[model samples]
Target: MEERPNNDTTISTDEINVLLGKLKFSEEESVQIMSTNDGKNVKGFESWAVGKIMATEHPNREAMYRVFKSLWYTKEEVDFVALKEGAVIVKFGCLEDRSRILKLMPWLFDKCLFSMVPFVKGKNIASYEFGLSPFWLRVYNIPIELMDRQLVVAVGNAIGELVAIDWKDRNGAWTEFMRLKVKIDISKPLRRIVKLVSRYGGETIEVIKYERLPDFCYMCGLIGHTFKNCKDNREGAGINDSNAQYGSWMRAPFVNPNQERNMRRNGVEIVKTTITANEDKEESQTNSRDESGQSAQKGNEKEVKKARYRHHLWKKEVISLYMTAWDGLSIRGSA
Candidate 1:
């Protein structure tokens, strides 16, 4: 065998290269790596739609700069650029940061309202356009039994069109108790008189026009984009077209055979009238009982609960009767 060198003398090329790469020097030239886009698909620039500022006029460049400087986010966290027509484009450093800001949107900043919307991809940030957005109506106080998809769809169709129906599942499975989402037409005046009639038990479901529903896109059946800007193939009719017809249908008075049934039922007045009559008869007995040193507070509380339960039962029974009467009238109208 040839004479072998000692361990210190015989250095491995791989070990030498590794040691050289780790060496740092003050005079070394910094090599900057640049990405070249050869018309190939690359990572997208994360952005959000920022508009609906409540200021009298659009915030200027200096104002926006001051606003951002006052709020959260460092220079590296986000890139805020003012777009054409008072809109804004916010590019986040990461998706998590973007999501966090979106959750905090429609925020009240500097005593002005600023609403955030979903950004459209492949569209120039400076030229993206928006229009009068469709709104969402969250209907609470819905009875558990009447929350079927079919019933929700029927009620939603009457309002405008069923963008989506969210069901609240308590046990990770479908149940009778749920909530509903119905899209309302923004162009036409609200149809506040429409009632949903249940086919199974003939119960009249009354929905109150509580508040403006959140924006849900009918195109992609998702919540984000305001109306048809989702770029999905499915397009909804404008308020002038299909929504107008639906609005008219909803506003039409339901024809009940009895004139009393067709007219608006004064459930509160009925309850009050019945309660007053009962109170008058009970007042004399109550006075005598009070004179005899009987406790009247307990009895009065019991009477109030009874009256409330009675009023609720009476309202439900009367509404059911009206719905049944209307069904016959609807069949007659169809014939």
Candidate 2:
């Protein structure tokens, strides 16, 4: 009978280090350096963006790309390269196409929000943050008198960066609610309601409803994941859905364009408010209600300060979550 050698073997750290020490490299191959200018000359460096699909389960990369291509309908062809942790490097044929795609952000793929940011040269793609996205909000319960563009801008700024406003319909009639686009930070809880204080010391509550909102955590109010997969819920430290701070009421009803046209043809009259920029300006100048309205101004200032504070808190929370999640991932590589 022939003797067989053991197939399994283990190498200790010291043994591996000793073997590595025995290897030698030529002077020419020992050291190499590159400058930032070298990186700039790389292909697709000028027209690229980093994106992440905000979902735990990523869709088929090919299928997702096809869907995005159709949805974007850019003038030039776009390329998508999948990266670690559901991130992708998107290459556009031109800067125009890239800017257009980014402007129409918060795109939905398989019912999940896709957040993107313009690529920064020499920055690690993994370090790019995908926490902010623009959303169209339908603000309800706003007083008819305060439905002007100035008021909308003020409230929109308090919530997030104001992008644009839907002034009126084709018939020049105001909709039931104020519609404005604002960039929101998805890392923090969604703001469901905003309180406005008038110069008369009266308060009004405005209910915020998002259009085309995807699955989000009802318990924590964060977007990208449902409560079931939330860290708080996974650890059994979160509350039940019934007692959650957010609910379906936060989602706004979708308005169909065809339906709107039908309504217009059927002679349905929507409340008309012909507000011009000049009118808004005149109103502002005439009502220079000074420090007497200090209480109301202070209220708004306090809300803005609070929003800033919440943003800082969210950054800390995100850092903690990232560290905890990274620690759990099993890494395999050679030194």
Candidate 3:
């Protein structure tokens, strides 16, 4: 026999033969069990009772546990339990109260959109055949696996209404999940799509439209709002352009240092170079390193000395050459 786990969450996939099934015990001991049946029995076995019975026969305890599970299929499964002929009594597993399904509208709508359903709303809902819904509305393309049982009941409990009357068809036959779909009211949420679709269809650049709208500056025709509301402008821009000369934020006098007039007045604009006002000032100061004006006086002195020296040298050289030539000719004549 297989031993049972005291913990709430777990299961085993062990196997068991027919000998263990013949034994009897309690359901609590039989949890987290795995089993393979050697044969079938007319009477059905309960969860707790089987574990106690098999514990005595099989020392392994695992064998008995496997046998119990093979015959019972004890794992929790999604299922519907019926209270009456047409209605479900149990809300666990697959059988959830009708009101629970109603509150799933938002999740359903989101799922519908995720699944790429073109439109999802509750009015005249039968056309898309969402089955039975309690909110008088619905969104399609919802994944069935996502609808949790507890959530469905919670939704019903919150709204203080039955999510739906999980009823069998008029035929009064037991309904299987494969055939079941929900019914709901679809009128309200449907309008949301009308506007969404209108904008989606009308605006060609929807990405830019949706993302850029909040950022637009009315004064500049730029994104992120106008200068009046702009945080950047308010923080020491120091000037405002109430009267826009060029109908543009740039042309206006809104403390933009790049404006032409400000640049010109401040010498920030260097016509020949891309230097700023401070850089131009620095360049001019560098050219005037001799601020005491001694450099100018020294330059004048150098010029005067060069002129006087050139005049004296030319006069001395010419006179010396003339005397040498005359002496040479006189000596030749005497000879």
Top lDDT prediction, candidate number: 2
Note the Cα lDDT for every prediction shown: 0.45, 0.68, 0.27
Model 3 agreement with the true structure over 1-335: per-residue lDDT tens digits: 99987887522222233546777867986787667754233122111110011011112223322322232222343222322112221122211211122222211110111000111222221233322222221212223443343433333333233323222222232222111112222311111111112223542111101100112243333322345664445565543466432123222122222232222211111111212323555455456655755565565445444544443443333333322332233233233
List runs of model 3 lying over 4 Å from the truth.
1-76, 79-94, 97-99, 113-128, 131-189, 192-335
User: Model 3, residue 188: displacement in angstroms?
Assistant: 9.6
> Which regions of candidate 1 deviate over 4 angstroms?
1-44, 48-50, 54-76, 99-113, 121-129, 132-136, 140-144, 153-194, 200-205, 209-335
- Whichever of 1 and 3 has more lDDT, that candidate is 1
Q: What are the runs in model 2 whose C-alpha is more than 4 Å off? A: 1-25, 30-43, 169-171, 234-242, 257-335
Better of 1 and 2 by TM-score: 2
Which pairs in model 2 have colliding backbones? Answer: none
Task: Go through the candidates in order and give the clash count of each.
Answer: 2, 0, 52
For candidate 2, the lDDT comes to 0.68
Each candidate structure's TM-score, on Cα atoms with residue i matched to residue i, is: 0.35, 0.65, 0.13
**lDDT accuracy of residue 17 in candidate 2:** 85
In the range 1-335, model 1's lDDT, one tens digit per residue, is 89876764545556778998998856445666676955333223544445544334343445544454334343345656765456776656655555545433333333233555566666654454333233334443456666565665666667664543333333332353233334443333444544555557664546443222223343332323334454543454453443332222222233333543333222112222334566775676588676865666466546655554554454444344434433333233233
Worst-scoring 10-residue span by lDDT in model 2? 265-274
